[model samples]
Target chain A: MEQFIDVWIFGLGIATLTYAPPLIFAALGGLFSERSGIVNIALEGMMTAGAFFAIYVSVQTGSWVIGLVGAMLAGMALAALHAVATVTFQADQIVSGTAIILIAAGLVNFLNLTLFGAEGSPAELSTPPKPGGVSLLVPLALALVALTAFVVFKTPFGLRLRSVGEHPRAADTVGINVYRMRYIAVIISGALAGLGGAFISFNVSSYTENMVAGNGFIALAALIVGKWKPVPVLFACLLFGFSQGLASRLPFGSPELLNSIPYIITLVALAGFVGKSVAPAAVGKPYVKH
Target chain B: MTRRINAEAILVPFLAVIAAMAVGMVLTYLVTGWDPFAAYGSLIRGAVGSPSAIGATMLRSAPIILTGLSVMVAFRAGLFNIGGNGQAIMGLILAGVVGIKLGSLPGASHWIVALVGAAIAGGLWGALAGFLKVARGAHEVVVTIMLNYIAIRFGEYLLGLGGPLQEKGSSIPASKSFETSAQLPVFWRPDPFTEVHVGVLVALLAAGFAWFLIGRTALGYQIRAVGLQPDAAEYGGMSVTKITVIAMFIAGAFAGLGGAVATLGELERLQKSELAVIQIGFAGIAVSLLGRNTAFGCLFAGLLMGALDSGAVGIQNDNTLPSGVATKLIGVIQGVIVLFVGIDLVFRRLSNRIVGVFGERGGSGMVKS
Candidate 1:
């Protein structure tokens, strides 16, 4: 029994850490964009871009850091297209986001095929980089979340971003350059989302097709369930990560159905059986400044 | 004024298509270093150069049109139903169940019954989200997105290993081949291989029905009113909640029909894994946006998109370009088209101004939808 307890603890701990970084980073990405008045449903697409670039560049450069930078840049570039539509052109944010998802899937896969001749596996990272069995990215992820909380709550930029999201007109009245702020926030969102994707690729040692899977959407759900706050969002991600981490081990009728737990939890949270989600007032609405 | 509006409607989508295709051509050139004109020529040939290709394109349009109409119905009611794909799979699963189980029904009646069964399943799934919006104030967009996953997992449960829906003696998680009676009929085959199925007609008639329903019916007016001014609609004795629920139901039903038609007319049996994360539903969003959420608009847009998809397959056989690049080009074009369509106001202005250059009134092009 003592051995089982230790095994369970070690397994769950590893699984939890494994699953948490991507969700945390992506959620933080979502927080920045939403707090600056953009509905970024393109996180999934951005993650795909990030994952594709991370593996491709890492394989080519033989350096994880270079690959990580490439992934972030790729995500930002995709997000820029979204920003051009939702921010500059003042298009329907949802449509713009949906378009990004489609474009990313097609473009990344096509590039993968063209570049690697196939989705060839990269170097594996099954074991943690540190001897203590901790992924270096996990610590970075936690630090980033804390930094995000500080940036969102205590900084002038945070105040400005929140004000813009809360009331764009009011923010514009205060000479905030609503579009510029939103564009910057959205690009930053893309970069962090890209980092989240980088974590996934780095963890696995190689990127698979659709490797980001629906985790991007899962992070988006965590963002909403966390009430758009930084710390709470981290906890929400960890909770989801825990469920997903232990899903295969759960003695459910079918392991496939058990995989649905994270999604089900998100639904229950959204169902308002608990507390209702209050989005940033100007979310999903394009800012048409005078 | 109406004539101008009509002309503008046609012109804008055409311009968007032209601009998008042009960009697609350039991108293809940049990426694959292939000749853009030849690539497009191959695309057109693949889409409609032969009787078989045209028939294939038409058959593909049936699902796109139905799903486009699905998004159109929801948009009219001020709802963004992102779960068109989810709703479609529900429809497919229900249709499969009815097709397999309803053995007693006559051959002629079997397909109809299956179609209706699919629609109802889809409608119910859709209505659940609408109900949540009214009862719990859960945003439909998020709810629908989340609902998509549930439906997908539920589908996986029903069809995976030891799943209730899996066929006997089959290792794959797929249903048995549908009975002959359940299949949609194919009309005059212009070629030996070409089968022009009844689903194409069903799509057309549905488009016609949607047009009449949205343009002439009291329900459509109420839906539009609720969408444009929910408080005013409520004040005017139209139950905003009821309208929202009904609109979602109808939208879901159309997508259900899309799935049903695809199953009944196209595939011999329902495959579980393919049904999960199917792209047809997301493709519907593009169709709806490009179609301007109008019934006739959906028909043409469906055909155009169907041709592009068909052409994607068609271009591959030509071997002038890498199959990978050719296929990706279709997706790029589709994505660009939707991106352009998302900025509907911009294109409307561009198209209207182009028209104004030819017209005498010097139209300001200031009108908003």
Candidate 2:
């Protein structure tokens, strides 16, 4: 009985370490975009782009830090596409995000085909250096999460950003540049999402197709499960990580069934427990300069 | 003025599709470095020139058309049903199980049993989303997406070699070959040219039925009313919650039928395991959007997509382009179409003012968001 409990705890710890960096970073990215009144559903696509670029650049340059930076830039570039569609053209946020996802998928596949040809050669890339037997990225993620939580809740910039989200017109009337705030927020969101992607490539392995594998959506769930608060959101991500870790460790009758534990839990939580978590009133509403 | 606007709305989506195809042609040229004219010619030949190709195209269109309608129905009611893939998989598994268990039953009865089982499974899966939306105020988009993962995982578990539904003698992770008696029969004999089955008629019937339901039925009236304006709908004595649930149920049933058609019409048995890689359900979303969430639109859109897919196989054989490149091209075109459609309403206002060209637009007031 004691051994079982210890194993469970050990699994939870490993999960926290494995899952926290990416989840927190991506959720923080979501916070920036969403809090700024933009519905940023392209986090998944942006992360994927980042993951692809991180590995591509790292393999070319043999520098992990440069790869991470490249990943962030790639993420920003994808976000810029969303900005053009949703902000400039007044496109529907959902449709725009969906387009971005499809484009990202196509681009990745096309790049793979062009670079590796039909056989598709696997390229070796340098992993980010860790110190003191822990992934450096994990501590960096924790720090970023803490920093983001502080900025979102305590700072004046956070106040303005939240105001823009709650009522863009009102913020505009108050002389806040709503568009500028939203653009910056979304770009920042993209960069953070990219960082999460880089962690996967640099810390895990060379980018494989669909390596992000719904992690972006998982972060979105973590946002809802966290009640859109940064601290609670972090905890929620840890919970998901723990569930994932435990599931992986268990010698279940069917591994596939066991693997579905986190998703099923998330579905149940979204359906039955997350009661009417309201978004900012101005979400998905394009700020038209009347 | 309103009538003129409606006419223009109808033209925009069609123009959007043409524009997307044009862009896709350009991208295809860049990617494959092939002669554009030859590639397009091959596409046509593969899709429709040969009898077998045409038959295969029609057969492939069956599920997409139905699932596209499923998505269209839900979208009309202002819900994004991303769970089509999950629902379709569930339906497929349920139908397979029923078909195998009831193998002793007489001929057509087995087909009916399988079809009904699939429909029920899909309906239940879809209702889960509706239930969550109404009961917990959860967004259907998030819930549906999550449900998709669950469904895939569950399906993989059910279809695993040692799992329930696995073929008795099969060494692979797949269900048994459905009894020949249980299989959906081809309306026509295997001609030298094609593999068309009877499911195309069923898909057309489903399209016609969906069109009638949305256009003429009282239930559809409530659904549209709620979709257009929930507050006003409530004031008019319609239950928004009920409409949402019913709409999802119908949507799910359509997707379920799509899955059943795929299994009965094409595979005859569920093959392979690991659910994450299936593209049919997500492809349905693209079809629904490309069709502008309408019955007639879904039919044509489904046919176009099925043709592109079938043609892609031919393109792979004739050219150095990878098999997935063509499908990805279809996705790109679909994405471009949706992007254009979403911005079309805004663009039309600008174009109308700029060009002084006036015509009826079909969906001016219809696109709620």
Candidate 3:
């Protein structure tokens, strides 16, 4: 029984901490974008590119730090394109995000095939992070949760972002450059999401096509379930990670059934938990100066 | 309630398609260097050069068109129906059950029962999201996406290991063979190898039905009113809640029917582990967007997308380029098309140039952002 308790602690701890922070990081990414008035369904795409670049550049530079920075830059580049389409050209946010996802999925796969001539590239970092499958990046992601919350809620930048999301036109009138704020918020969101992707590649030997899978989407769900806040969103990601970890670990129930828990929670939450689930007022709409 | 059909409407989409194709051509040139012109020539030829090839394209299009209509309808009602995938999967699962479990029914009746059951399942699932929006103020985008995950898992379980819906004595995750009468009958058998089922007709009928419903019906007017201005719609005695629910139900039903037809018409039995390739539901969004939420627009867009798919497969089979590279090229092109479609300026500017250069009259349908 004592051994059982220890095992359970070990299992649950691994499930909660190591597995969940990446999702939290990705969710934070979604929070910045959606809270700033852009619907970023392309978090998945951003993460995918992040994972690819994390491995690709890390392999080339022989340094994880460079790989991580490269991953963030790659994600920002993708987010910049999204910003251009939705912010500058006034494209539909959802459609433009979806386009980014499609473009990323195709480009990553094509590049992998063309460059590597295989489905995945080898992990080339000499140190090759493997401390009980935990890395400094995981803790960095967790720290960022608090950091992001403080920066977003406590700082002037956060106030402007929230104002722009709530009323871009009003923000524009107040000399708040809504477009620039949205662009910055979305780019940051993409960078964080990319970091999550980089974490995935760093954990594993190579980056696989569709490796990020639906984690970016699940992270999006976490953002919505957390009501687009940082601390609550971190808890939400933990819950999802716990559920996903539980689903993946314990060998009793069907894995599919386990996988369905987070989604079910999201459904019930969205179906009116206590009050209405409200997003930022201007979320999903392109901000146009009137 | 007549929508102005401008020449810009026609020219813009055409230019977008051409530009997207050019991008694909350039990507192919850079990546594979496999004679972009020849590859494109074969792509066009494979799609329309042969009657049998056109049949194949139509067959591939049958489900995509229905799903496209599904998204188009929801968009018309001012809702993003991203759960078409989930809804379609529900339809497929329920339809599969009806097809396999319902014994001793007449052949045609059995198929009809399956199809109807699938539609109901999908409709109910879709309506659930709308209900959440009306009651809980939950955003449909999140709800639909989350529901998609649930639907996919539930479908997997039903067809997965120890699933009640699984076939008798089958170890793999799969449903039993659908009843013979349940299959959609083929119309033209120019090539025994190619499939040109009556699902094509069903697709056409569904498109026409969506057109009439959105264009001529009072319900459609209410939906459009709610979509265009929900606040104004609420003040004008229209029940925005009811319109949203009904619109979602119809949208889900269309996609559900698409799924049922795809399963019944396209294949003999359910593919056990096909969750990875079930992108048709999400792909429908692009088609609907390209069509601009119009039924006739979806029809042409569906055909264009179908040709792309068929052309990609042709490219893959002929070994003109690496299979993975060629397929990715197609995806890149489709992605480019959607991006251009989302940004109307690209097409509008090009259309303006054409009008200024060729037309005697000045044309203007540019939507100022």
Candidate 4:
């Protein structure tokens, strides 16, 4: 019984907590952009910018808090570009998103090489403190889930946002500013994704190239799996985190193959095992003001 | 009647390239403090200055052209295939298997068979995504992205320690070298350092094939019809499901051929590290978009991108900038180009005005739905 609690409950629980928050933050970010009638797959790009800026700021300012803010700003910058392209210019969201992804990657890696040189960020830097063997951001992430739920489902702004996403034409008739709401939602989405990226970097206490890997994509999967609801998205992220935790714990199996389990599960979720995921009616369509 | 040129089609892309290059110059100056002129001078010289540089550019262009065609085909069917990397991985693995295991085949048949096997492998991988989309309603973007990670992991396992494909009695995590007969025949040697193979010819053939398939064939018409309006196509007795799957297969096949050509053309064996860092798949996206999602357009765009890449190498060789800066700058330039191309409304108006000034009204470009 003790062994079972030690491994299955305690160990598994810690690992999940460590891994799931990033996905939660990013998935929630996806929720905002998507619910505001934009398909922002550039969540990955925004996260990349956040991840790089977090470490750089942490090193420079010697403050983890400032680092987190820097991360969000970086993400927001990228997201603003996405908004300009997709919302204002009425470009293909996917194409614009792809461009952002490439740009973020190149720009971040360029800055990393030029600033940090070959050795990378210093051996020591200010990272968030772990009060109970987990970072403070973990609880903050949980709080944001509740916060997001309240903001998205229980507010007038939430109603306006949903209206813009679902029926923008009608929403426009009702005096809701569709473009302003979308830009705000997408920018907020960037902030959240940036926080997610910061969490991943802070966990490691340093930055590495491609360190975020495909977690942004995984968070995207979580958004789909969670059906874009705040509570359900939290559960989906936890599920992915649990799988990652379990993969690390298994006594036997190729680590490479084991690492793929989360992705495969995401594929299965997207394949409709969790049920059909229907996007907002007006999502992915650019609204042209006549 | 005199044929009126569609000035927008030619002008917008040309202007976008100029805009992106300008952005690259500003970025280089702001970040590196390097003289943008000297950097660009070195870049151009590296791209087409010498026989060896041109050879290198051609070598790089071949795979990108094929992958570009891969993306182009899928775009015609109204599908976005972001899984070119995954498809290419599937192709390379099968190509590696055929190249390493099949030693008995005589002459060019061995390499030819390898390329065919690669196409089949890549096609099947792509078809899985299409099937999931049609049968299960899973978005291809998410599915294909997941597939890319899965393919990387799978390939890593195959080549990692104690795996089936790992070299026997060696510590290195890579497959055994291919037999001499399995390698592509090199037709040109610009210098002792550069051995140009027939992959360029293969890319050209594939581009021609794509042009014929999308422009001439009955299936091409169906693909275009479905892409334009799936509801109308379905009402007209076309199976959207079947077309999606077939188009994805063709897309995957071209990408797969790209992988095989790159591997057989360049490497002796498949290395484990290369699987994670393969940029050709994503590069295909830029190639397709910049090419305006056409076969010949892909050919020119791929060449341009390849030149930029080889030019980065030139920047490094000339010591014009710090190491690793040039490549990343080129990447930023490519991304900017894609952005400019995506938001081409600004360019369209400019092109129209220019055409008006010339007393020739510009025709509407192929506007993406």
Q: Which stretches of candidate 4 lie over 4 Å from their true place?
A: A1-8, B1-4, B320-323, B362-369
- Clashing residue pair totals per candidate (backbone < 3 A): 0, 14, 0, 0
lDDT of 4 by residue, A129-155 (tens): 998678899999999999999999999
Whole-model Cα lDDT per candidate? 0.84, 0.78, 0.83, 0.89
Per-residue alpha-carbon lDDT of candidate 2 for residues A1-290, written as tens digits (9 for 90 to 100): 88877667655676667766787888889888888878877788888878878877777788888888988998898888787778778887877777777767766666656655666535566768766435788878888878988898899899899998998888889999988888889899889999888886666667766788777877887877776788878887787766666666766577667667667666766765545456767888888988
Worst 10 residues of 4 chain A by lDDT: A246-255
CAPRI-wise, candidate 1 is medium
Docking quality tier of model 2: medium
Off by over 4 Å in 3: A123-128, B1-3, B320-324, B360-369
Docking level of model 4: medium
Report the Cα interface RMSD of each model, rounded to 1 decimal: 1.9, 2.1, 1.7, 1.2
Which numbered prediction scores highest in TM-score against the true structure? 4
Clash-forming residue pairs, model 1: none
What is each candidate's DockQ, to 2 decimals? 0.60, 0.52, 0.63, 0.71
lDDT of 2 at B207: 95
lDDT of 4 by residue, B44-94 (tens): 999999999999999989999999999999999999998999999999999
Per-candidate alpha-carbon RMSD to the true structure? 2.6, 3.7, 2.9, 2.5
lDDT of 2 at A265: 66
Give per-model TM-scores: 0.94, 0.90, 0.94, 0.96
Give me the candidate number with maximum DockQ.
4
lDDT of 1 at A280: 96
Looking at candidate 3, what is the lDDT of residue B181? Answer: 77
Q: Indicate whether candidate 1 or candidate 2 has the larger TM-score.
A: 1
